[model samples]
Target: MTIKKLVEQIEAKKSFLCVGLDVDLEKIPTHLLEEEDPMFAFNKAIIDSTHHLAVAYKPNTAFYEAYGLQGWRSLERTIEYLNERHPDIFTIADAKRGDIGNTSTRYAKAFFEDLQFDSVTVAPYMGKDSVEPFLAFENKITILLALTSNAGAFDFQTRSLEDQELYKQVLQTSLNWENAHNLMYVVGATKAEYLADIRAIVPDHFLLVPGVGAQGGDLEAVCRYGLNKQVGLLINSSRGIIYASQGRDFAEAAAASALSLRTQMQQILDAR
Candidate 1:
């Protein structure tokens, strides 16, 4: 989907909620274990229940990759199902891939061309050559990792490089690169205070924010500093929503959790 369409959907739904599908076999409802493809079954139910409440769906590739071929098939089917059923919904492959140019090109093709994801999370540590390949694709987005929500982020991202923090330099450097207009950023919600500075550098680009629920990132704090004129934020919640219950009513509970976030998002947008 085009970025314009994504913004439109967010506006129409009164939400910029992006539901993360970080499904783990051990965490999903036990009853789904009897199904032929438990992972897909769980995902299918989640999508059916919460699709209306969310503008985007992000599936962390590692979850499916861990299950081997069965897991991969589930992911493929899930993407195809979403594309066919809800083509308007923004899809992201949370793969965090970055490598040399040739390798990055193949990775880009694998996700954007083969699986047809609207965007993919990419590591920017490799610099322009690794990221440019992904940017070459028309209409597909390259969401570069900036300041992340993890504890380890302090080791590098926040460290002073020259006069500026490393992540701030990253945002400034990336903005000057070719095809940078298609770039979105991955700024963790846990680092909400840095967002005003981050936004000052790249005010118009959408930010795909993680760390909202399970990671203890405050929604209000993130919105307060990160929000832009276009509602340039996709606040994500994975465990808090998808694993809201471990019983047969898991999907219903998931929808409720998602609706709660969506409602807050609506208020944020209205207030803006």
Candidate 2:
């Protein structure tokens, strides 16, 4: 889908929420373990319950990779289900994959073609050659990792190089890449203070921001600095929403959690 369509969805739903499908079998309700594909079953339940409340669903590839063949199958089925039933909802493969030229091409194909995700997260340390391949796909976004939510981000992302923070350089340099309009970014909400500077670099591009709920990132602070006229942010809440309950009412609890965030988002939109 185009970024225009994504913006339309956010406006129509009064939300820019992206529900993370980082499903952990151990954390899911025990009852689902009996299903032929417990991971997909749990994901389906959450997606069905909260589809109206979210504009995107991100399934970190590691979750599926850990389970081997069955896990991969679950991931495939999950994407197919979303495409068939909720095609409007943006899909992200949070694989964080990057490699040399040829390798990155295959990685892009795996997600954008094989899995058919609307976007995927990629590490940009390998420079332009590593990311340009993903941008080749029309209408597909390549969300490069910038300042992340994890504590370890400060080690390199914030370090000054040539009198500029490395992350800032990444954003500035990306503008020169081919088809840069198809590019988005992963800016961790935990570092909300950095959003202002980040936005100054690329104010119109979409930001796939995680660390909002479970990691205690302030939603208001993120929006104060990050939101564009198009609502250029997808605030994700994984464990905080999907695992709101472990009992029979798990789906209901998940919906409640999503609703709370969506309501807050609506207020922000109205204020805008």
Candidate 3:
């Protein structure tokens, strides 16, 4: 999906919520396991229940890869279902992948062409050559990992080089890459304080922010600094929404949790 369409969805729904479909078999309802594809079933229920409240759905690749071929198949079915059923809703393959030039192109093709995800998360550690391949695709976004939610982010992301943080440098340098306009960034909500500075650098690109719900990041603080003229933020809530209940009413419970967050987002937008 184009960024314009993404922004339109956010406006139409009054939400920028991105539901993270990081499904764990053990945590899902026991009854779903009876189905041939439990992961896809769980995802379908969640998406159906909360689709109206969210503008995006992100399925982290690790969850599918863990189960091997079956898991991979489940991921494929889930994306196909979304594309077929709700084409307007943005889809992301949260497969934080980046490698050498040729390898990165193949990875990009796998997610962008074969799977047909609208966007994929990428790592920037390998520099421009590794990431440019993914950015080369038209209408597909390459969401680069910037300041992350994990505690270990300080080990490298925040480190100083010539008195500037490494994450800032990544944001600055990435702008010069090929098709850089298609770039969005992953800025953890836990690092909300750094957002003002981040916005000053990019100013207009979208940010896929994780850590708002389960990770205890403040939504108000993130919005205060993260929101741009176009409302450029995709706040994700994974465990907090999807795992709201493991019982038979899991999908309903997920909808309730999503509604709570979406309502809060509406209030934030109204206040602005």
Residues 1-272 of candidate 1 have per-residue lDDT tens digits of 78899999999999888989998999998999999999999999999999999999999999999999999999999999899999999999999999999999999999999999999999989999999999999899999999999999999999999889999999999988789978999999888888999999999999999988833348889999988888889998899989999899999999999898888888888998
Q: What TM-score would candidate 1 get against the native?
A: 0.98
Candidate 2: tens digits of C-alpha lDDT, residues 1-272: 99999999999999999999988988999999999899999999999999999999999989899999999999999999999999999999999999998999999999999989999999999999999999999999999999998999999999999879999999999999999999999999988889999999999999999988943349999999999988899998888998999987899999999999999999999999
Instruction: Choose 1 or 3, whichever is better by TM-score.
Output: 3
- Which ranges of candidate 3 are over 4 A from the true structure? 214-217
For candidate 2, the per-residue lDDT at 94 reads: 93
Ranking by lDDT: 3, 2, 1
Candidate no. 3 TM-score? 0.98
lDDT of each: 0.92, 0.93, 0.95
Candidate 3 lDDT tens digits, 1-272: 79999999999999999999999999999999999999999999999999999999999999999999999999999999999999999999999999999999999999999999999999999999999999999999999999999999999999999979999999999999999999999999988899999999999999999998943348889999999999999999999999999999999999999999998899999888
Worst 10 residues of 3 by lDDT: 211-220
Total clashes, candidate 2? 0
Clashing pairs in 3: none
